[model samples]
Target chain A: MILTVTPNPALDLTYRVPRLLPGETHRAAAPAVRAGGKGLNVARVLAQTGSAAFILTTAGGAPGLRLADDLEASQLPSELVPVAAPTRSSVAVFDESSGETTVINETGGPLTPAEWTALHDAVDRLVVPATCVVGSGSLPPDAPDDVYARLAAAADAHGLPSVIDAVGAPLVRAAEAGASVVKPNRRELAETTGLDDPVAGARVLLDAGAGLVLVSLGAEGMLAVPPEGEPVHARLGTPLTGNATGAGDAAVAAVASLLAAGVSDPSALVRRATAWSAAAVLAPLAGELAPGFRDVESRIETG
Target chain B: MILTVTPNPALDLTYRVPRLLPGETHRAAAPAVRAGGKGLNVARVLAQTGSAAFILTTAGGAPGLRLADDLEASQLPSELVPVAAPTRSSVAVFDESSGETTVINETGGPLTPAEWTALHDAVDRLVVPATCVVGSGSLPPDAPDDVYARLAAAADAHGLPSVIDAVGAPLVRAAEAGASVVKPNRRELAETTGLDDPVAGARVLLDAGAGLVLVSLGAEGMLAVPPEGEPVHARLGTPLTGNATGAGDAAVAAVASLLAAGVSDPSALVRRATAWSAAAVLAPLAGELAPGFRDVESRIETG
Candidate 1:
């Protein structure tokens, strides 16, 4: 079973508007609301692929209750760590005319020190039985910046493979803990490492103790640098042009699920992860993978 | 006690952003969520004036739960008639640099027929002991178009003076039900009555059986026409340049609270209502009147 942790999850509300003109009164169609976060998205994709996945998230107030209710109603499995602050809502306005999507994110999770510890304890308990653990998304304000690093450290101590799908200090700390893999998108890797060269940035992360580094290159697909093997580049023949918000999450799911299934080859994992990321773009929702993922996976090449 | 009903109330989420650029990702500031609708706005304003006003509205799902919780936290009085559908959320993006407010209304209240009848019955029960009844806002889809008319008809039969703040078919029907007063903004009045002149449109409503009609003219203030008295126009000395979303609701609140206090004179009612409407714009939030209402009232004209 793969366990995913999202410290700052959101109740996502996506509304489809005809034109989406800014500074105007728009009448949005019925919104599609769901539980959304990087870890939650990863768990959802993992579950859809027939992999057992459990989501560990923090939720509070009414939006949190709604997120919990949605998780129950969905095919994904989850456990919530309750808190006092209301979970945040992310609004996405899809403009039909221009084929554009506008996103407004409300960052939340004002967790007390006790609440943060509760998450740590829950994760500690779940990691023992978990085949692999994944920590994703931004840490809420005031949360110790090294929380993800600590999770990676704990997973390492337990002899469990771990994946960290985050950026900034958390990403650096996770790498320092020597997690099985650390996946950062092109921009995040560059921003956190403050390096112009992507390969150099990945090397920097490897030096910090990561066993493997997967840098998502967007349209160019993915790059994999393993400790004992040659660097590999994987890409689909044709680039997908759809919502890219959850593509990285899908990649994280693929990496975690592949590792949990005992696929130790970094090349095989990157090929599968890149295909799944493309599938996420084809799907309409953020936490969903398209049905054609297997076909897409067959077309991806790693060299 | 003044009784107010909002058949399709909302959980309002307002976010402040430095500037809103369409089709872009925005990191919004902390949002302000509240229970808001025409009737609830009226009830809140009445509460501020030391009048006992009870809000009767249908609430369901998570947003409804949040709205109920917010109402409980506020000073206003309310009772939520439970339903199965979640209440809708209307998001307002306030641009700080430009001082522009963009509103996105998610039209909802897909209330089942059983839910509609439940609201009707609840309103019937509450109106019995009420000093005056007020029904406001647009009815949700699937609800009978004559819902407000029916409420007005019930108020008439119970000999309860009532105010209806609505537009279009609902507004016309409410007028036909002989509601004690019907307030429609100038645009709504002209659109419903198909008259270019707001005064002529108001006259048409009075002819349709509304004992009085108050037409809001934005900066020009308000216009009142009674069944037996000549039409009177009231205006504050200056126009307010703040949020005017709830100005009309404040007018309804002033009218209802005054009627409950046994002030039946239409001219007197319109003067105070205009002042309160101006005060509402001066204040930052809906359901609140600025303390300068008395000063604004002293400068208002009824001629």
Candidate 2:
């Protein structure tokens, strides 16, 4: 079983509007809501692919209650550490006319120290039965930047490999903490490492003691850099044109699944991650893989 | 005591964004939430004025739970009728840079027949101690258009006056049911009665057996049309502007308060409603009048 941690989770609401106009009033039908966060998306994909996954997160207030209820209805196994602040919501307004979506995200929290401690305690309790540990998404403003690093350290003590999918200081901290694998898309890598070239940006993490760095290049696929060896690059022959919101999380799911099963080959990780991500893009919503994902692996060209 | 019915109550969420750009993603802090619907807004104003007001509305699902919690926290008297469908939300994203707001309203409910019957039952059980009945806002999509009319008829049966603040078919039905007062803003009147002239449209409601018609003309103030007397016009000496969203509801609140006290004089109703509506415009949010509302009435010119 893989254990995933989402420091900040959201109740994602999607509304379909006839058109979207700034500074105007719009009336829409009831929205489609889901329990969402980067780690939860990864866990959802893992579960769909027949892997046992458990989720650890914090929620509070009405939106949190709603998220808990949705998780229960979805049959996803999760432990919600209650907090005083309400869970935030991410609203996506899809314009039917132009097929464009406008998103509004509420910056979740400045979790109290006690709330953070409760979350850490939950992770400690749940991590024992997991084969691999994964931590993803943004931290609350007041949360310690070394949150994922602490998770990596905990996983190391447990003799388990860890995957960290995050950005900014947390991503850098995860690398420095010697996480088994760190995943960041091209933009995130560039921003965090201050390097425009994807390979150069990934090397910074590898230099910081990360065992592996997977840089997602969106339609172009992915690049895997090892501490010692030539980087392996892989991608599908035809790029998919669909919702790309969950592609990165899907990549994390693939890497975590392979690592949990004791697959460590750089080329294999890159190939599977690329195929799964492409499959995710073909699906209509996040946290879902297209039906023919198995065939996508054959189409990946690795070097 | 005033009984207010909001067929479709909402959890109103207000977010302050740095700027609002179409087809772009924005991150904002947590939203301010309140129990909001037209009738609830009316009740809030009445409560603030030291009047006893009771709320009757249908709520379900998580948002409903939140609304119920908010009403409880507000210390307002209310009875929430449960239904299968979830209550909807109205989100307002205010752009701090431009000082403009974008509103997204989720059209709530097509309440089941059983749910509608339950709502009617709640009103029947709670209307006994009410001095006046106030039915406000849009009915749910599947609800009978004569919902407010039914409330008026119910009030008549109880020897109480009814104030219907609605638009379209519901507004027309309220008038035909001989509601003591029917209030609609200029735009609502034009759309419902198909007349550009406010007085002419108001006259239509009075001719439909309405005892009185109050037409809110926004910054121009209000016009009162009594069934057997010349229409009275009232306005502040100088127009004060802040937020006009709650102006009409404030006007309805004023009329309800006056009628509850058995003040049936058209000129008095026009003067008070006009002053309160102006005071609401000067207030920053809906369901609140500016601090100097007493002075506002003294400044009103009724002719």
Candidate 3:
């Protein structure tokens, strides 16, 4: 079983409008609401791929209750640690006319020290039954930067591999804590390490004690950098173009699934991650792969 | 006491962002939330002016619960009729850079026949202690156009005057049901009645059995057209500028307050409504009036 920790969970609302005009009023149909977060998406993808998964997250106020109800309705196994502040909401306005989307994300309130303690304790308890631990998503404002780092160390203490998908200080901390794998998209990689070169940026994570670093390059596929030996490159002959919002999470899910089964080869992880991410691009929405994803791995080119 | 019925109440969320760019993602501070609807705004203004006000509205789902919680926290007296469909949410994005706001309003789910009947029954029960009945706001997509007309007719049945603030067919229906006062802005009036001349358009409502038609003319103030008297025009000497979103609701509150107190003179209602609407413009948010609203009435020009 894989255990996923979402630092900042949200009740995501997607509104569909005929057109999007700046500074104008729009009347839209009721939005599509989903229980969402990076880790939750990863867990969902894993579960969809026939892997048992458990979610550990914090929730509060009315939106939190709605998120809990939605998760239960979707039948995702989870435990929510209650807090005082209401959970944040993410609104996406999809314009049918231009085929574009505009999003607004609420900055969630910082967790209290007691809430943080409860979160760490929840992670400790939930991680006991898992073969792999995944900590993903943004940290709440004023939250300690070592949140995912602490999760990595906890997973290390329990002799389980950990995958950390984060950005900025949290991403560096995850690497420094020696997470088994750290996945970051190209933009996040450049911004976090202040290096425009992907290889040089991945090296920062590898030097910081990460066992492996997976860099998603969108249509170019992925790059895998190991602590020792040469980095591996994997890609599909033809890139799939669709909704790429969940591609990164799908990649992380693939790596975690492999690591959970004790497959740590850099090339093997790269091929699977690339294939699953491409599959994700072909599927509309997030957390699901295309139906023919089985044949994708065989077609992936790795060097 | 005044009874304000909101047919389509909403959990209004306001997000403040540094700037707004079309087709771009924004990071916003936590939204400012309030229980909102035109009728609720009218009730709020009435209460602020020391008029006893009661709210009758339908609520459902999570946002409805939040609306009820917020109303309770603010100490507003309200009775919520439970419905199967969740109440809608309206989002306003305020851009600090350009000082403009973009709004997205969800078209609320239509109430079932059972739900509409329950709303009417709830109104019957709640109207016993009120001196006036006020029905305001948009009708749900599939809602019968006579929702406010029915409210007006019910108010007449109880010998209570009604003030309706609506648009389109609902406005026409309210006027046809012989509402004491029907207030619509110049634009709503022109669009609903298909006449560019405000006086000629208002005449349509008067011919439809409406006792009085009050047309809001933005900075030019308000026009009160009574069934038997010549039209009275009232405007402030100098228009105070601020947020004008809630100005119309404030006008409705003023008229309802006067009618509840047995003051039905067209000139008196016009002066009070003009002053209160101008006071609302000077305030920063909806459901509030500037502190010196009493002095505002004295500076008004009536002709």
Candidate 4:
């Protein structure tokens, strides 16, 4: 079974407003709440794709309990490590008129030393029989910067394939820890590699010891670089425009699922991952690939 | 003892961002949560003003629990009537560059029949010994629109004064129930009376059997009209400009506090209420009148 870790999970709230006027009160047409974090998104996509995965995360206070309840309501399996402070909440206001989305992400709760130990214990317990482990999203305040790197190292020691989807220093540390795969968007990849050309940045991540590198280019699709194989590319034929919040996480899930299913070909994995990312963009809800996404997967062209 | 009822309270959340870009992710600088509703605001202001009022409201589910925790943390005395569904949460995004505030209010949870019964029982218990009761804010979904009217009637039956702070049909209903005082903003007074002029609107509400009428005009201060006394005019020399989210509620608390203290003069009440309202606007925190706001009350002009 796949184990997904989201250190800084949140209660994701979406408000649908006709138009957002600054310094004005808006009554939302409909409001929705979901359990959200990058690893949780990956776990959700994997579950939807008929894969067995367990979402592991830390949650606290009433908001954290509500987040767990929301996941339960969605029929998603999860195990929560308890903490003292409440989990953070992220707000997304969607304007129907402009199709614009404004996101306000709360900085997640600070993890105490005991809470960190509890999470480490939970992860250790889950890693024993896990075929793959995915570490995603930002670390909470007070958490060590190299926490993801340590988790990746533990996965490597256990012979479990590890996929890292994060940004900035966390991404760099995850790569150095020999993450089986690293998925970073163009902007994050630029920050990581300090390179303007995304293709060159992908090469840098590959050279940094990532067994495989997947760089997502919004609207342009994805680029893939494998350790021992020639690079293959898949670009979107149609502009799949929608909320791209969880597209990268979905791509990580796709790649992990393909690799765990024994698909070793780099080009085939890239083709599948890009199609899943595009499908996620087209879907109304975050982390969900479209119903007929598999049928459209073969239609994607390689560059 | 004073009783303050908030039928539709909210978990008020504020997210501070350096800049808010539509259709993009923005990291929050800080996030804060507080109990919100017109009646709760009144209770908070009353507490700050050295009046110990019992806050009576529905509390259930995650948001409601969080609001209750916040009130407790603030050391405000409260008696929560439990409900099945969670209270609503309102999001305010502050953009520093534009000095713009974007508010997204969630639709409030409707109280079940049992919850309504519990609220009614709490009101019955509080009305017998309470000097004054304040019924404030909008009715939650599935709640009777005349709920405030019923509460006002209960107060009247027990020889207790009820200050109604609501708008539109609810204000009309409370007035019809002979509320001791009704505070409606200029727009709400116009909507309720079909008259744009505050004097005319105040006359209409007095004719509708309201014992006293206080019309709040943002920046222009307040206009008070009593059943038998001359109109009391108390206007702010300097317009209190801020978010203006809970200014009216602060005004209601001032009126309630004065009425409970046996101050029946409309001129003095309006002066104190307007000063408190202005102070609330000046303060950054909702429901809190600034320090030395009582000193400002003495400076208010009453003609």
* Superposed model 1: Cα runs more than 4 Å off: A28-30, A59-61, A82-85, A112-118, A225-239, A261-269, A297-303, B28-30, B110-129, B158-160, B225-231, B236-239, B261-269, B301-303
Q: How does the DockQ of candidate 1 come out?
A: 0.60
Off by over 4 Å in 2: A59-62, A81-85, A109-129, A194-198, A219-221, A229-240, A297-303, B49-52, B59-61, B82-85, B110-129, B194-200, B218-223, B226-241, B265-268, B297-303
Better of 1 and 4 by lDDT: 1
CA-based DockQ, model 4: 0.62
Tens-digit per-residue lDDT, A84-200, candidate 1? 988888988889998888888987857998998999999999998899999999777777878899889888888899999988988999999888999999999999999977788
A1-303 per-residue lDDT for model 3 (tens digits): 899999799889999999988778799989998998888888889988888989899899988988998899989899999999999999989889877778898889889999999999999888888899999888899989899999999999999999999999999999999999999989999999999988999999999999999999989999999888998999999857677878999999999999999999999999999998988888877788998877999999988
Candidate 4 regions with alpha-carbon error over 4 angstroms? A113-125, A158-160, A227-231, B227-233, B298-303
Candidate 2 chain A: 10-residue stretch with minimal lDDT: A236-245
Rank list by lDDT:
3, 2, 1, 4
Number of the top candidate by lDDT?
3
For model 4 chain A, the run of ten residues with the poorest summed lDDT? A22-31
Instruction: Give TM-scores for every candidate, taking all chains together and pairing residue i with residue i.
Output: 0.88, 0.88, 0.90, 0.92
What DockQ class does candidate 4 belong to? medium
Please give the CA lDDT of all the candidate structures.
Answer: 0.88, 0.90, 0.91, 0.85
Residue pairs whose backbone atoms clash in candidate 1: none
Order candidates by DockQ, high to low: 3, 2, 4, 1
What lDDT does candidate 3 reach at residue B280? 96
- Compose the digit string of candidate 2's lDDT tens values, residues B1-303: 999999998889999888887777798888898999999989989998878999999898888988999999999899999988889899988888887778888999789998888988888988899999999987777779889998998898998989999889988998999899999889999999999998889989988889999999877889999878799999999957577777888888999999999898999999999998998988888899998888899999988
